[model samples]
Target: MKLTHWWPTALNPISNVAFLRPIDGGMKLAMLFQLAIAASAFSLHAIAAARPNIVLIYVDDLGFGDVSCNGAKAISTPNVDRLAARGLRFTDGHCTSATCTPSRYGMLTGEYPWRKKGTGVLPGDAGLIIEPGRATLASILQQSGYRTGVIGKWHLGLGDGTLNWNGKIAPGPLEIGFDECFLIPATGDRVPCVYVENHHVFGLDPNDPIQVDYKNPVGTEPTGREHPELLKMKLTHGHDFTIVNGISRIGYMSGGKSARWVDEDMADVITHRAVDFMERNQAQPFFLYFAYHDIHVPRVPHARFAGKSGMGPRGDAILEMDWCTGQVLDALERLQLTEKTLVIFTSDNGPVLDDGYVDDAVEKLGSHQPSGPYKGGKYSLYEGGTRVPFLVSWPGRIRAGESSALVCQIDFLASLGALTGTDLSQIKTAGDSQNVLPALLGESQIGRQELVEQGGGNQLALRSGNWKFLPAFAPKNAPAKARPLELFDLNQDPGETTNLASQYPERVNEMRQRLEQIQKNP
Candidate 1:
């Protein structure tokens, strides 16, 4: 009468119970109860296995019209197109902000970035912005038994205010919620041009320590401004500091020569690392935030992709990014994890040319429109600034279609929480996130009733239904002008050319009040 003797090895609890013979009625009752517990445990394990692995491929400066599926003729994104063909493509998807840092902040924290101070575009030497021990999206998933990791551009900063690059860097990705991270500390155009793997620089040498500064020059390295002949890529604006890999970056860095990354090989390196993470965690559900640094400034694409597009380095970088997406998709298919994994592809913000470098992105632009049919890009508070390509694929779970549901990246935390059946009540910081799992899964055609969009200088816009409201506000240090409130019925004027704020006074007042209420409450 040992229960172990009758325990099912293959979880055939009922079949195994047939072979059990009890010595007494009490023994029979105990054996049946134990068998039921074993069956229940097996069912729980099956449910856990059914939870889909999530991979969020966040790109940098990629526009709404960059992909072939979204009507781009100059560039071909076969991989991304394939994803859209097999999944849901969002026509009205957007990031929370026009800039990178704030959009990333809002997505991860599930709160409006403007509500918090110091969440603007950060310097290269900035400290970890997301406070440690806080409830982030990664932390929520991690608590729900998902292995979490972030690979590639982690512009969310690292360590405390006083960070020593040579020593162990704490309060980084590890402290926030991610179990592991391989990051490009800030942006590609910034310094400390080295990879940070978890707590230490990837390949640091003890002989040469690292020092980074944004205010002044730290090293005797020839800069783009000082030595123009040394540069492989010319500078157009402010990125004229310490040179690494023949290109000057935004900040100045002295040492860590051994760990400096080559811009051309970055896509390959990060893609391989992302594929490896998926392979290692194939047995259990995992969350991978594969943030790409491609299509950004200093657009030094690999030779394999060079001149492949007639649109120069910017177009070539788009192809390189597509290749990275293909690599991840291939890995999923090879591992037989495609059907069991949910993949989301999107950009941090809209596209921009001549950001900081002279990469022929403007001259060779030809007739291709990076932001598609929308007006304004990158820094403007227009449709093109925050609106970007968004695709979601979960194989058999999500049907292939297009949805114009008004979705924003800020809702990811609550949506994912709903998907994983996590208890969101315990996490009190997710004030701005809404659970739009049905919208995300193609079960619903409607999303957020109202969404806020932020642009350069913290300029805010409100989108309610088919109308967009842009309140007037002069930016810091700009010449004063009579800037009136602007409104557009997006269904009629997606370009936002017609300002109807005067025509509809009531609508303008209503949206203006709503925007103020969100700002005051949120």
Candidate 2:
């Protein structure tokens, strides 16, 4: 019946004879046609199976306007700019939450961080937040035959609550499906400041075992509050607990001296590890979540990048971050994996000038707006908090252009899950993560129809189209005032200055209902 199918098996001998004789031209043509069809099908299937290498460059505390491509005139992120120039730059891209822990949780697990307890910013010694056996981005990709590795800031907690630093750290990135992990278990500013490689602290001497305690001082380590003279970088607030590397941290540690990571050399060290990962795994498809440590608190750049940005440590850190990004880009190019890799550059949350360290961010700002034209920064329920710079580059696959599609980091699970042919329906806890792969590829202008934005605690806001609605909630530390429901069209008021809650009560009510629905269901 089907010439393409039957010709190969049944008429093979006859077709060959016909070709040999050069008489039965019709048979030769049919055979040729069948072969061409078979080859085309095989080629298509091969192309479909060849999944591209994925590199998620998750930056810490970077803002929307921090890169030059996104309107930062004061500072230039050339690597990030080159990425934008070659791929899709999303203007309305957002993370699930405005804070680090929640955003990372959402990114890895494909579930809202608010749904889980203890998803808040964890200390260095806190237990793993992601439950064991949970389906994660790394896990999903690993299932599809990709080598998953996470390098750099891993603020996601490690091990059980009674975690012994000297012993094997379980239930970490390895347990969560990552094959390889070299990480800062928590934030750079936090303590027990040692690099955790795979399961144990890197370079930890067994003779001088490591000990960590967040509640109390462990040994004779000088503290910033007690000994301000020892601090090279002065603390402005809560970071005056324990001194490590001449800088005060939030927690205390005694004897991980051999394993401690220098603040300035973090970028270089992590970049080397990441590039090494790429080089080693170049033969196979890999998922490398190379999170940057620069541009975070206690902004200590290498001597090369020192004073490069006039905006003090903050600006210098941005430059350092850009350099780190360039290194990865260079590695990808060197390995000839640029066209075969999908590199996504985005931040965990928004920006903050004076987040516990006195790095002169406020006084030396010099008219550089980190959060762009949006109101609020890291901790608020405004656009600036969640709406961050998002760039996705896949060389020839994703066309270079700007897209206003409202995408979120939370959706990566579903989007990539769909991309790699994973069954999203089987993923039990993919909360609020929709597959907008087409939008990510710059094929579609529309992204999520509605998205939920989270603040510090249980506070929430709904973003539908260009309109944003925040339910009535009183300010925490502000003066006594009844802050009513607020709504603003982002297209009209990008600064979020005017509250149109009174004008559109019905719309607010609808969005509020939608928010409640998502939260309750999720």
Residue 216, candidate 2: how far off, in angstroms? 1.7
In model 2, how large is the Cα lDDT of residue 107? 91
**Angstrom error at residue 38, model 1:** 28
* Residue 262's lDDT in candidate 1: 93
For candidate 2, write residues 341-405 as lDDT tens digits: 99999999999999998899999988789999888889878899999999999998888999999
Q: What is the C-alpha lDDT of each candidate?
A: 0.87, 0.86
After TM-score superposition, what is the CA distance of residue 471 in candidate 2 from its true location, in Å?
Answer: 0.9
TM-score of each: 0.90, 0.90
Encode model 1's per-residue lDDT on 309-372: one tens digit a residue.
Answer: 9898999999999999999999999999999999999999999999988888999999888999
Reference-based TM-score, model 2: 0.90
